[model samples]
Each structure stands twice: as structure tokens, then as C-alpha cells.
Target: MKLRLTAAALLFPLLCGAAAPQGAPGEKMRTEKVLRMFLSTSETGLDPAVASDNATLSLLENLFDPLLRYDYLARPAKLRPNTAAAMPEVSADGLSYTFRIRPGILFTPDPAFKGARREVTAQDYVYSIKRLYDPTLKSPWAYMFEGKIAGDETLRKRYGPDVPVAGLQALERYTLRIRLNAPDNNFLFYLATAATGVVAREVIEAYPGQAGNHPVGTGPFMLGDWKRSDRIVLLANPDSTAVFHATPGHNAEDRALAAALEGKRLPRVDRVEVKIAEEFQGRMLGFLNAEYDYLEQIPESMTDMVVRDGRLKPELAARGIVLSRFPVLQTYYMWMNMNDPVVGGYGKDKVALRRAISMAYNNAEDIALLKKGFAIKAESPLPPNVLGYDPSYRSPVPYDPALANALLDRHGYSRRDPDGFRRAPDGKALTLTMHSEATVGGRLRDELWRKCLNAIGLRVVFKSDKKTEIIKASRLGTVQMFESNWIADFPDGDNFYQLLYGPNAGRANYARFDLPAYNLRYEQARRLSDGPERQKLYFEMNQLIHAYNPWVPLTHVLSGDLRHPWLKNYKRHPVEFTAWRYLDVDVAERARSARGRGGNR
Candidate 1:
């Protein structure tokens, strides 16, 4: 069923909630309804250090709160205090960061924990960061903060076969100092992720094996119960001061950031419940049927239908749900494995081959066929929306098969065998394995990719696997060329720059391309305080990416979520924190007052 509906028809029904069988208004009126969420995978674990997948982190966000949170509408990537008393002090070089701990911040005890019920302290932060790097923990992300924190090597050496960890330290009771080997401006943003949220050290010690399952945080919601495949419940924190509301007189962005840091009430919602739904299509259908109060990962198909039909504005109004949209700094690219001989046939001439391969396909057509007008085609690794994207600069290659063929010929790939396959100068047929995740649009991509390669006399053997399988293959260096996308953990250029760094560099570098000059500038860009200097470094680094071409940049993925109209106070920030927080959710005030909280469970 083509979900192509006219906008006017969709909005017309929103004028009356009764017209739509199931709407946001009807769902919100129910007291104890569970919010059904669709996730592609069964959550691996809740440990922030090892939590790599987005799906699992999304659920964990409700159970944790970071020291500083992002104010999306604020300027220059606003950093508002959560557990901190004020903004952190960043050294002139951006290496040292000191924060004054907020007084009276308590860490609630988990039901599974045998620890004493008490408030969290700076010691917990010290222990938490150090624990992840402990050799005994075997945390994959222990290296993420490698050069940033002190004692990393000592900890690793001490715990080599026992329990090594080196990065974290506790200076004083309320004041903490963190020293980094190098400067990273976005380090504050990294601390904002739910996976990095602070936890009580006692909680971890009490139930060492069950820490992930039974979590605790200072967020407005407490982790009540989390059952794999059944349901996840977030009970309201009785002592939580989060009151989601805009300041009455504060209109300017700066004023709001100031107010947020002052510990003003933010969210209005009391509780949040998430029911796991694995099937993506089922989640979309159920959302349209209004079975959920709010659906975080909106079905892409339904978003397209609403956009084409123009029913979003009216449907949301009639149902009392709010619609919000923003651009996210996320890019989808194809990673070419240089380690494999057959796929890496171009070897030393990899840059020329990468440039040629980049020009073979029309990114615009790919978006039309795969993304359906939801995404923007990207020519550079850094999109124009990013801080230092150079608009005047352009890549050497263009979208032309003739040009692609010419580049190949220039690079000693001139021969085309009888079967019309490109061969190396040695008369060996060059073949590559193109790997892709089996998503909703995978089949379409398979057909489109085949056509693009055929035009350039290149034969591609496509392997489509589940998302997890594809990621594992890329990390293991088993795939030649594969599809991947990265959403910035924080709104900074380094997040993208570090991904293409040397082998086993950061979170997203699976292909492991190492360029010393590139890494040097990447480090400098993070440290340089001058705006112009940072811009220059970032621009130079990005241009080098085009010259090197380890990964072919494609397009920025457009993300959206569908919610019933009655689901109010729900909003999403652009970069950084994309998941919905329970604080913004406002139960129907009138309905709640009338029912007197005596309705359903």
C-alpha cells in the first residue's frame, strides 16, 4: 500500500478527533497505558561504557541524567547544568575541566542493589569512569577517553591481567578536576549521553553482575522494571524537581539557558512507560491506530505518508499532540575495506579508485529511490550545516561515468574484459564485495547499486545482512565495501573527524584508516581556542578527507517520529540528545484533575 496521501485530506480529519478512530487525545485520556516502542534489536546491556548501540541508549536515557544537558534552541551548543552547580571550567587549551558538584543530588537505590540508600558524590564519578577502563570490565569503550584522562596507562598496566583502569580521578568532595592528554572541546557533550551518566559506586559493587539490568540515575524518572521483550517502566522520582515549562517572561535564548542552570523546574510529566516492539512495520501500524501514547522512533513510511498528504499539522492539533522537526548532524557513507586483497585491488592507488567510485553514482537519485525526499545529498564529509563546512571547496570527482572511467584509466585500470568487467593493469579482474544492512530500503538499494556499478564496468557482489551483522562485519575487516551512518554524539566537528582516524581510533572508525597529518590537525582543531584557527584546521582536515577517500560520504539521514495529538510537551533537540525525556510529557491537566488520579494503574 503506497502511503501517498494528500495533505488536505489528512488535516481535515484532525479538526475532529472523533473522525480518526484512534488519536493522540484518546490515548492520553487513558491513565495507565503503556507507550509501545519499536526497537530493531534486543538491548545488549545498560553499562554506559559498553553501550554502543543507539536503540539501547535510547531506553537508558530515561533511567539516567547527565551532569550537563543540551538546550537545543540555545546558541553555540548550549550546555546547561543538570547535576553540576554551574557550567564546567574549560582550560584555555581545552584539556582541563573542573566542575562544582550540585549539592543535595541523591542517587536512588535500585531494588536489586544491596547498597545503602544515599546521595551520590564526586567519588562516584571518579569510580564510574575508572571502572569502565578496568581490565576486568573488558569495556570496549575504555579507549574512547584514553589520552583525555590521567592514570589511564597506570590503571591498564596494574589491571592488565587483573583489573586495570587509568582515566578517572577524584580531587575533592564537591569539586572535581579532570585532566586530559589532549584537548577535546566536545568532551562536555560526551558527558551528556545517558551511557555516561553518573551512578552510585555502591550500586555497582552491591550487584556487580546485574548492574546493567538494574540501573539508577539522578534523572526525573527511576528505572522501575525492565524486562527483555516484555516492558520497561520508569516511575516518577518523588523528589525530582524537573518541571517541564517555559519561563513566563524569559523570551531570549540566553535567558532560558541561564534559567535552566539555576535548577528551575523543567518537565511536567510524572511517569513514562516503554513497551518493546521489535517489528518496525507493526510499530508504524500501531501508531496510526493510536495504540501508544507516544512513539519515539516514528515509522518512516508513515512520516512520508503524512508529509505527502499534509495531514501532520491538523492531525496533531485535533488529537492534541505536538509535531516538531529539526536537522541532525548525521551522515551515511560507504566504507571500503583496504585490508582485503580481492576488494582492495586498487591498493596503493586507493585514493584514485575512491574518487572514481564516488563519481559513479548519482546521490540525488539514491535519495529519491532509498530515502524518498527525507534526506539531503552530501558532497563533503562535513555537511554545510556543520560549523566549518567549506561551501566554495569541491571534490575532484563529479557524478559522471565517463569521468569515473577516465580516472580508472588514468590509474592503470584501463582494460575491460570480454564480459565488460574492469581489470587491473595485470589483466586480473577487479571485483569488490559491497555489504549493506537489510533495512526497509535495502532491496531498492541493491538494485540501484547494481545499476550504478554496471555503468562503470565494475562488478559488485552485494551482501545484505541485518544491521548488527553489517556492523560486526565492518569491525572485523571482513567486508570490502559496506554502508554505515554516524549521528554525532555531540554537536561538534571532531565527532566526525575522529571517526576516520587511525585503526581503532574512536567509536565509529571500523575501517581504521590512519593518517598522522590528519590526526595532528584533528587534535589541534579541538585545542585551538581561536574561532578562525579552529575553522581553518577543520576545513583543512575535511578537504584532506576528500583527497584520501577512505570512506565515501553520501547523504545526511533525516530522522522523524510520529506521536498522537494528545501527547503534549513532547519535543526533540536536534543534535546530541535526540531521545524524548519524560519531563516534557504533560498528562491532560483537565482530564487528570477531573479523574483525581483514581482511574487506572
Candidate 2:
């Protein structure tokens, strides 16, 4: 049933949580509960369709509702309906899929509705997905939909109600249908991503170029306050129908949370404040001083101070800080842009040059020195939790300076310049450049890389710039090589392999590695259901990567989170973003600690 709520009714909960359901008698008398944390990086904008940065797109996770979402507590995430009434019905051929969105859901009240409520509908979703392909948006995620959705390329994401669109359709008021050019089981997982989250047409029309600053959605939270690059505050959506509930999970953590928090109105905390602090020391100090309620992924530099042997130190544990450690579904590596003249190509010389460089760099040393022993050397494209990942598989290449030198010499990089550096086969200067962030950790990595390259008589330099600038240059194919990492979007091997897919060059394939054999294998593997036969293709694809090294597989990071004793019902989701709606803050204990610690004011 529609709530028939007014604008103030829709936003009051987000602003002050005044409409929140009352707790047990006398327990609800405390001040507003706030879940305060810090984001290591700054968010770019609110438009999910255009955003690729993890931090920026996450804002949409709370604001916009997607058709499906990964289970909040389940590992190797299972898809569950978010705004959808239930799972989409798939045809036998798997080309046609139909989704029935839950009715009565309304976008958080906005002036764009002209005082009338804008209930979310199938049309809104169609428009939202179209935004990703809108050429004007310059969306980085368009690659996910490109050539997959059976539609006229000329229409792009702008397929409208009157426009004759073939693949996407709003069949009924609350029903949507998506037709794919080919069969793909992973397509359902793509719907869960923020890139395809629904947006109101009225909101888009109202806000012209500044859609990022002004966001409206039917999710459990609303944008309350924002200060660019400094602080952001989110309030609970008063009219939201979302409630906190956990499914039967693999661990005791989810079971306990389910028992204690089932049926609670979403966004248990009154407000969420994210402070953008890029430096490790600043975030560490804030956590220690009780200025922040959570510290996510404590940087390697401070890993020893906060954790010992992967456990919280006794000194900090005495303060009642809780530690949760998990091997992140991510792989850190250096990707050589395959389009660049120096590094790009599938020729023998180019392949040998890349393989030699990969062998020259030490993964174990980088993990120990830069990651503070909090990571395992990655052997393949897929990280630990993804399907088709084989832990037994080891990389054919190993760290050996002598072998790297020999490989380079055989490839005709034998001439030496006056500076004791190797010259290209064509007698031209061969100076390799790498891009990294200008941070303390980045500098340490630079020192290690420079020393390693020099060991093989190869001249190398690092271009340390702002992270945003480096990313832009890399996407434009200007950067030669850069150490980067990819965290799983969904718990599937296809997600990792797609990074090297020739078609995904500028999007997920930052390395731009496009070999015909690898692309064909990826397509074949992607079409098959996850099983033994598909796994055989996975093995072949990974071996192809080893044969022609476009990427240097580094390490799979072991990340840990620190939560104050006052925080409750919080745990990391393997695939889901933040469970802030399911999280609880102990207002009384927080106040007591703040008073004792001289208050974070």
C-alpha cells in the first residue's frame, strides 16, 4: 500500500530519525545514534551511471535501489530481490528475462515531483539503465551493456517509451523485460550493480548538470548534508519500506545478527557521516581517539600498531575495539597498457619484454614490505572467493633477475647506454615509466620498483600524481604502466577475466590486453554455466595470460576492519557494499566514551 506521505514525512527520518519505530521502553531516550566513519578516498559524484570509483558509486548504494542485490550477510553472495517483487522469470532460451518491481515504492520526496509523489516504476528503471549508455554522460560502465543488450546501437541508453527499442521494455506498470543478444547467467548479477540502479526521470529533468549534488531515490537513506571532499551526511528515508532481515548464512555472525535485528526498520542509526581523510595517520589517530566509530582497511603502515598477528592488540582490545579480518576478493597488480607503442602488442618482442619485466619484479617482497605481510601473492586472475579459482595453480613466471636479463637480451634489448641501462632493440632509449599515488605508501613502492628494475639494468621512473589524474590518463591510454587492483564486483571468475577481454579495453580492461584466442575463450566460458567443462576454459584462459604477460599478478590483500565496542550488528559482506541500514550504534556507550576521551567536538 502507498504510504501517502508528504515531502517532510519522507525526509524527516533521514534528517533526524524522528519517525523511527520506538525501541523497548526507556531504551529509546538516548540522543541520536550516529555511525561515523572515514572514507580513505573522496567520492566523485552521485550519478551512479557515470561513476567508476568505489567510494563514489557506494553513495548510490544507499540512495538508489537496484532490481536485485547480493545477500547482505552471505559469502559468495547470492542474489536477492531489492526493489523487485521477486526474482526475474527467465525463459528456456535465457534470452528473455522479465522482472516485476514491487509497487508502492516512492522516490524520497523532491521538488521535481511538483508536490506529487513519484512512485518507482518499470519505466524509471529503463531510463536509469539507459543513462549508462547516454553518450553525453560519458559513462565508464557502458561497456557492461555494450553489444550484450539486443538494441539499436544508434538509440544507445536513450530508448524511451515511444522509441522503438528491441531489448528493453516496460511491459506493464510494475513489470520490465530485458532481452539479451546471447545467453549469460551472470547477467542477473549485473542488475545488482549500482550502475543500473533506478533513477526518477523528474529528478533528472529537474537537475541539469548537477545531478551528482542532488540525488533522489527510493532506498533507505537520503542525502542530508554534503561538503565536497570533506564530509557527507546521510539520513534515513522515512517512507522507505526496507526492513533489516538476514537470511540463514554460513557463519554465526549472521545468525546472531538475524536473531537480534530481524524486523527492525532499516537504517538503525539516525545518521551516517563519512569524513574524507586520505592519509593513514589521520584516520588511525581519529580511530584511536574515539573520534570515529569505524576504521576500514587500516593501511599497511599502521597495520602493526592496530593489529598483531592478524588479531587486535591487547592494548587496543582493552579499550573494547573489535577487529574483523578477511581476505578481500581483490588482486593487486601492475597492468601494462597494451595500446601504447612501447608496451602494447602481442608480438614476440613485446610479449617477451612484458614477461621479463613481470619476472624482474618481486611479488613476495612487495607484500612483505609495502603490505606489511597482510597479503598473499596472487598466482592468477581470479581472487580467492570467486568461482573457477584454483588455489593449486601457480604462475609459470617467477622472480629472477638473471632470467629476466637473458630474456631481454634474447629479445634484442642487449645494447647498453652510458648510464648502464639497457637500450631498445632499435637502438632507441628504453625508459619505463610507472604511475602511482603520491602517498607515503606510494613512495615506498616506488623505491622498491626502482631498485628492482635497476637490478636488471633497466631504467625506470615513477610518475607520482594525484590518484584522479593518474586514473584519467590511464583510461585515455596515455599511461604506460601502473600498479592497480581489482575487487570483485560479483563472486564470479568472469568478472576477473573480463578485465582482459578485448572488448572491455577502456572500461574494465585497463591493461587493454586483447588477444583473439583469449577473447574467444572468455566468450566461450562466459556462455557456459559454471561447471567442470567451463572450468577447463578458465584454465586455458589463465594459461594464455601467463604465456603473454600483459599483467604482473602481485598479491591478494588481507584487509581488516576496526569497530568500536559501541557499534553493533556490523560485519563485512563479501559482495554487498555497506550494511549501514542493518547496523546499530550504542548511543549510551558512545556518549560515555566520548565524555571520557574529551569528546570529538
Candidate 3:
């Protein structure tokens, strides 16, 4: 079946080159030196202080630079200095950190600069960190530094906007000193995240309350044009002097990738144009028609057509298309709102109900039938690549329909109504309402949910809506149960545990799970260094989550990206938000390939 384009896709003409005058064939085929891609949904905004979605975070990563970044090809990801001169100097107590800014870093030219060279200084970072604490902004990232920074809590309580934070200080023009309330080994990793990407104070002040739309920073790309939901354009910063430096790789594949990317000035493309294509079919058609250089996330429905026997299909391969796969630090799960009256309780019956539901849903079948074997059945919340993940840890909630039915029967749900659905203890019809998106894959998952729930003598009702609508409903606590995933902001177990932490309720904790013992263990684990002790704590937390069943851990997806062969040095970073700087596109080669493949649609 041919894909249908949405009205939004139809509105923007797919133009990769400038049109030459009437009879000039050679000039008509001129390449634009641009990288074209698609965003599944419109970006919420680009302000690092408030942007939380993947689309916004990805854009912000290129628009701003953090002090440190994750090594592109490392397996167990390592932190490296980006804007910092070197790794921070740590005090013996581990509570104090001192870093010096790399010289010659300048923000992209903007009105905020006021005709002066806006070089990045240590104070810029100090001010950027302070913005997270601004009460009016209410940055979602505030959780990262909440109690860790020594005096931040007090400053947050008393300050409104642009107040000086006591825990952070600019000791010199290039030097920054940060004092934390306690020792945290994972603190450096936190700084490496896109959430901490430094923004210039002048820019924030110039566009007060609108920095999300008007971003200015010292990164490889600057915002060229933005049309809200239609499109976004990023132009390579002419003033950027960032170069790709090689790192010693742990394996042969890493070494080869590093060698190919070494010493190249970023970003290789002159411009990046991102078009909004909300439908999977539209995105797939765009990629196949040579309108896009890369397909970032391949739709599950088209996975078989694109990839055959773990490789690109013959026709696509002959057209110089290549597939790259990487195991991401992400997990998709179904979360039950523990705050809901039907699902929330500490009693045996409540726990049994949740566990039975978890058991009834077959994650293995979902991976095989829906994901097409592109995912690993998740056993724990901490995915494979993270520090605290345990390979031997097995989920207590296995797929067992008989066990599920028996559990429900024992819990006083044995009575059946006229529809053959179970009745509650009070003789009311037992029905569950789940929120899902109105996408193809969503419909398939909802069907499976209905099948599984019906097998356990419960009727399931699905409320289908758009992706943003589902997210808004879930965040407002209006969703009783929902399917969601968390992509790690930093490669740490604490990042995952925060989703279940009571303090993060209504924010990251979509499940609204509030178990004091689990919360206590989560807090204890955060304070401990990464070692056997911390892994033990992680295991304990996993066991608690398994018993409580707030979220039935589903699958850890293996992300696949298909790109034109001319897109060189494209390696995936498991933790890093942006890696466009390391990528180079061969515009001539792409044009030649497109011509050989019978030209663009």
C-alpha cells in the first residue's frame, strides 16, 4: 500500500535544490548542501531550562554546548570535556568541583551580543545553572540539582528570577566552582546531559519568556528559521571552531569509526532542514523517495520492508542505503497509576491484581510480532547499557494466563457479568480504561491489551488520542493507566529510579507510585557510589517494583537508523543528545546516487 501524506506535509514543498532558469539542465540539478530529516511531532520548544520532550532536547543539544559530553563510540559511556578546558578538579571531600572554560568559544551572532564578541565565560555557566532554580520558569531539570547543590534549595525558596545561587560561583574569568551538599560520583555525568547545556544570560534576557523560540548559544548550529509546527532550519555556525578530536577506542569498530571522523570541523553540512511528518507512512515514503537523507526512527510497520535478515533490503541497498542499529538506553512499559482507586493499595489482593495483569500481557510476543524482533524483552527497569543493570535478574511477573486467572479468582473477582467479564467485589463491572495514541502500532498494542485483559475476565476500554494529547492527559494525572517510555537523560540508574520516586509525582512519575520503602531505597542508592553495594540497592528496588507492579517492564528497543551511503561517519551515541557535529555528508555523492536511482520524487 502506498503511504498517504498529511496536509501538513503537503503544505511544505520538498525542495532540496534551487530551481535554475528555463533551459539550464546542469544548473537545475545543483545540490543545496543540506541534511533533510523529519520530526515525528512538532517540537514543544527549545529552551534547555524547560524543554523536556525528545524533539526539543535533540534540537537544544545542537544549539547549546554543555561542559562535558559522552564519548561517541564508547560501550560503557565515558565523559569528555566539550566547552571545559579539561575534566573538573575534585576536592578530597568530593563535594567541591572546579572547572575552567575553554577559551575562544563564542556564542552565535545575535542581537543579544549587541555588536560585541560574546565569548563564553565561566559566569555564563554559573548563570545558566541558576536559571534552573528560577521559580517562574519551573525548569523540569530542577530535580537534577535540587538538594545536591549546597545552597540551591534555600536560593530556590527565596528567589524569583536571575538571583545569584550560593552553591555555584565564578571564581575567575574562566574558572567555575560548584559546591554540592554531599558527595556524588555521578555528578559529572549529570553535567554532561543536555539539560545542563549552557545558555548565555544576555540571550535569555533579550528574549525574556521567549528563549524557547529564540535560542542563542556557542554550538555548531544556530537557529536559521522556525515555523512552529511546520518546519525548523538550522544553519552551520560560521564562527564555530569546534573540531572532531579522536579518542582511544575500546574495540576495533570504535577505532575505525573514530579514525574516519578524526579532525573534521563540524558540522559537515551547511544547513539542516527538519520537516514535520507526523504519520509513519509519510515518513517512510519521504525516505524512500530520496526527499530525506536519513530516517531517524524506522516505523515498526515498515521494518520488514526496510530490513531483511538483519540488513537493508536488496533494492534499498542497491540504491546505496545503509541500516545502522544500536541498543539504546531506553525502555517501554505500561504504567498503572498507583493513585487510582482501583489499582492503588498495599493489600495482597491489590498486589495480586496488578501482578496478574502484568503476567497476562506477553512482552515476548510483543517483541516478536509487533517489534519484529527489534527489541529485547526487558527484565528490569535498568536497561542493558546502564551501570546498575544485572544480566541475571529475572522478572517475577512472567507470562502466565492461568496464573493470572487464578490470582483474580482468589482476589474475589470470580463473578462474571452478561458480557463474560469479571465483576468486582461490589458486583460492579470490572473494566479498565487505557490511554493510547491513534497510531497504527498503538492500535495493535491496544488490541493485544484487550485480548490479554479479556483472557483474565476483565473488559478493557481504550481512549485513543494524539501523542501530545496523551502526554498532556498523563501529566495532569487524568490518565488511569498508560503506555510510556523513558529515554535516559544520563547513563545512571538514578535516572530510571526517579520515575518511581514519590517526590517526582505528576512529573516523571506517571505511575504515581508512592511506596515509602521503595522511595527510601531509591534515596539510599543515589548517595552511594557505583559498585556492588549500589547494584544491590538497584536489585532491591527492582524487586520492590516487580512486587508492586506499578509499571510492567516491557521491552528495551534496538534503535535502527537508515541513511544514504553518502552520509559518512554516522555513529550512534547511546547517551549523547547530539552527534550531528561528527557527521559529514557527501553532497556530490548523494546527488549522483539520486540521479542513478532515477532522481527524486
Candidate 4:
């Protein structure tokens, strides 16, 4: 069912007991706790293995613990030990990695634990990694370990759960050894991701389809209540004894954040209540009314109202709202399916068609008009702030409608129908189907694509589907073209390059681009450390991608998050999602802020 974020329809009644004023009797706020927030989209699920979307992963970051985690205040995204005793010991060959699990860590109470001790061990991580190879699960992130983990792909392809994976093994109760097929420098980064979060083996056996909804992990927060698409609550894990001591920051900004967060127990807020606010306007209004403590991403539609000259509006600033802006390691692009007949081919004509389409679309205009100058026009798949991203690089496909028309005309697409739309070489109407989610922003982006395609005399039609459905269709190679984005799973160029790798086709390679030369460079780059030599390979691969035009690199967004004054020690991470741990709420201050704002409640 489609979620509608209308305040009147979705918001709980202000008079209801659950919506009572802060510090009200029987509410968690009475104890000066509770962090209220909202989710703009419905989460797919909380299972780390299958949670692919940002919403689900965001929650899982707190619900589960990875061996290593990104330092909250680090700009370059430094990895630190979380569940591991320290960084894994790597062999000289870089193929074998050994990790010692931290002791005293226990999973939140669950039926799966039965009467046994809940202490996390190396065996738990071994069991979790094996789940990625489970064919029945069909995890989108399985590609992260597919051929890299020794014997994993073979077991999945040949044995099909009949045999165990030989690569990941628990050497002792506390030690785990992982053998990779090749030297992968980014392997540790993958382990730091939520997808590698260890789960209890018994939990999977106890709750089959409901494991995701009923999560049991060794993290700061535990799942409390979930009302499908309406609301989700995460309560502080009583079993958690984790405390965060601030690490030295690299800059003044980092130092300031560290000063505010130093020596604090994880999950300062006792509870996190996330309301479903699908509509941007409603979400922003809710924040203004003090119904929410923080606004995740500043809505593009409300950018002007909330921000002026890169600063929060004077009115909002007066109300004690703090705005944090940082360039995220993500790239939003429009993918052209290489498998489609009209748009796909290795021939000159087909390449010209794709290049023409890329040139016709103006990313600068999209940023100014649609994104309100909140995004950087991307010239390559690798966005700024990630390794191998070159600031000097320029996009070869500039906005040139005349050049686009000339290319199309020269490529035998010159014939125009009665309605003025260009026809294919075979005299068939050249109509392209672009798929997008049926959200407000999605519709706006679709309209922009329609405008640009029409300028080049090409007819464009939009196919609106749920975000999950569109993603599934793209992975299945059923969608001709679609809008999508990739946030870096790690700070490496290989993460972006692998999206076009031939073997990854029908998975992360939604464009179905299969160039042998590009794949070789990607493999070579993945094995090398981040340096000038590896950077050269990245540049070369990016050049090939630019010429191929499988995707029209759109924008790299500067995430703008607004937090109420009562929210303390809030710092945005460029790549990490576990920032909630360091955040603290001033309950009395929040009550005053809410009381001062005489809206609805």
C-alpha cells in the first residue's frame, strides 16, 4: 500500500495520550528521555542481510554492531574497533585476515538465546557471513562477498546450502580467520558495514520470515515497537554497557563536536520515536511544530523557506534550529539500460544516441531549479570526498541540444513524426520509458527529464512505481531507464566502479554495461592500495565510462540536516549511519521549545 504523509490522515491526534505534551504523566519524557524523529520513507525491513534501502540500513546501524565502525567526527571516515578487540591482523599477502572479537558483548534478550549465554563470539560472525551466501535469502549485497570470500560462491552455486563455506572459520572462541580469493584492500570496509553485523544463529532458526521485524543484536538500541508504515520506536538496550569517549578531531569543527560528545554513554536518549512522514511539506511542518527533534535531509521543496545564503533562515535561526551541511559520498544518476535495443549497442550509432541523451540533459539546471543549489553537478561516477575523485576532471557530455539533435539526425534518427517526435532508424516512434518512484520529488525529476528529452525531439514517458519495485525491475534488467543513486559503502573508487562491472550485471550493474577493458581496470584497481597508481586506473575507468555513456551522472548532494536546539552533540557523518549513538536530548529544553511553539498540539 502507498503511504500518504498527510498530517490529518497519518498524524496521531494531538489529544491522544500517545501525543500528549512532553513531561506528561506515564510518558518516557517524564524521565527526561525520548528523541522524537520521523522517516520520510517506509523502511523495507531491519534485517542486516536483506536491508538494502537507506532507511532500513539507518535503523540497522543502531540495531546491530559491525566488527569495526567509522569514527563519528572523522572527515576521511577512519575505521575503529566496535565489536572487534582491535583492527584485524592482515597477512603480508593481504589474502588472510584474522580478527579477535571483543569479550563481554551480549545480544539483547530474545527467545533465540534460550538459556545459553548471549555473549558474542567469533563463531557468531562466521555464522553471519555464511548467511550472505544463503541462496534463499537473495541479498542484494551478496556481491560484496561473492567471489572474494573463498569457497562462498562455489557453495552457493553448486552446493546450495548442502555444504558449509570454508573461507570464514572461527579459529578459537574469540579469534576468527577470513581467507579471500585475492588481495582486496577494501575488504575490511565491507566488514564495517551493517550487512556484516553478526546475528545469533538460533534467531534465524526461531523466527523465519519475522527475523527482520524482530531483531536481536549487540548494539546500543533495541527494537521496541513497529506499526508497519506508520511508526517505529527504538528503546535503549538495557543490556548495552557501551560508552563513547571522544577521539581527537582533525579540525576545528570536529574538535567542537568532540567537546560536546566526550565521555558520554551511547544512546543518551532512552527512546527514539520515528514517525512516517512521506510528504516533505508535512515533515518540515512537523519539525517546525516541535513534533520532531531533527529533520534528516532538508527537503528541496522547502530549501528556500528554511535556508538563505547557505544559512538557516533568520526566523528559524531565532527559534534555535541548527543546520548542519556536509557533502555526502554519494552520486545520483540516470541509468540507460545497455540491454535495450534502441538505446543499447556497442556500435557508433548506439553510442552516439546515448551520448546525445547525456549531453541534452543539463545537470546544472537540475541543481539550480530542482535541487536549489544544494547539489554539486557530478562529472564522474566518483563523487567528491571519496578516494580517486578528481576535482580537475570535467564532464565531456556538456549540455548541447543542438549537438544532440545533430548526432541524432546523423545517426538516422532524423525523421520526425506528425507530432514532431523523432523516429528511430527503422521509422518507429522513438519513445523512451523512464522509471521512478511515485513520490513528490520523483515526479519533479521525471518532469525535468521529459523537458530535456522533448528539447531533443525525443518522446519520453514516465513509469511510476514504488521505490522497491523500481529497484527490483532495474536489477532484473526489465527497466529501460531509471533514476537511482549510490552512497559509498566505503571510501573507495572501486565501490563506484564495480557498479558497471560485467559480472555484476543484473545486480548493482543496472545499466548492464559489460565492457571487458573497464572490467580489467576495475579488478586491477580493487587490488591496489589508495595511491597515485590506483588513482590513474580510476581516472582511466572513469574516462571509459564517460565515453560509453551508460549513465548520465547527475548530482552529488550536500546533505543539509536541521536539528532543534534541544538536540545536543549532533554531528553529521559523510558516510556512517551510526550517529544516533552520540546524540543526546535536553528533555527540559525540548519541553520548553515545544511549549513555546503554539502549533496544533
Best by TM-score: 2
Q: What is the lDDT of residue 328 in candidate 1?
A: 60
Error of 2 at 15 (Å): 7.4
Q: After superposition, how far is residue 184 of candidate 1 from its true place, in Å?
A: 3.9
Off by over 4 Å in 3: 1-32, 161-164, 248-257
Error of 2 at 308 (Å): 3.0
* Candidate 3 C-alpha lDDT tens digits along 549-584: 999999998988888878777777787655677776
lDDT of 1 by residue, 474-588 (tens): 6667778877777766666666777777635333677567778888887778665537788888777767776767777888766555665445444455565433443343345
User: RMSD for each model, in Å, please?
Assistant: 9.1, 3.9, 5.3, 5.2
Give the Å shift of residue 8 in candidate 1: 51
lDDT of each: 0.62, 0.82, 0.81, 0.82
lDDT of 2 by residue, 540-590 (tens): 988999999989998898887888989888788776667777788887788
- The candidate, 1 or 2, that scores higher on TM-score is 2
Clashing pairs in 4: none
Candidate 3, residue 200: CA error in Å? 2.7
Compare candidates 1 and 3 on lDDT and give the better one: 3
Q: lDDT, candidate 4, residue 301?
A: 79
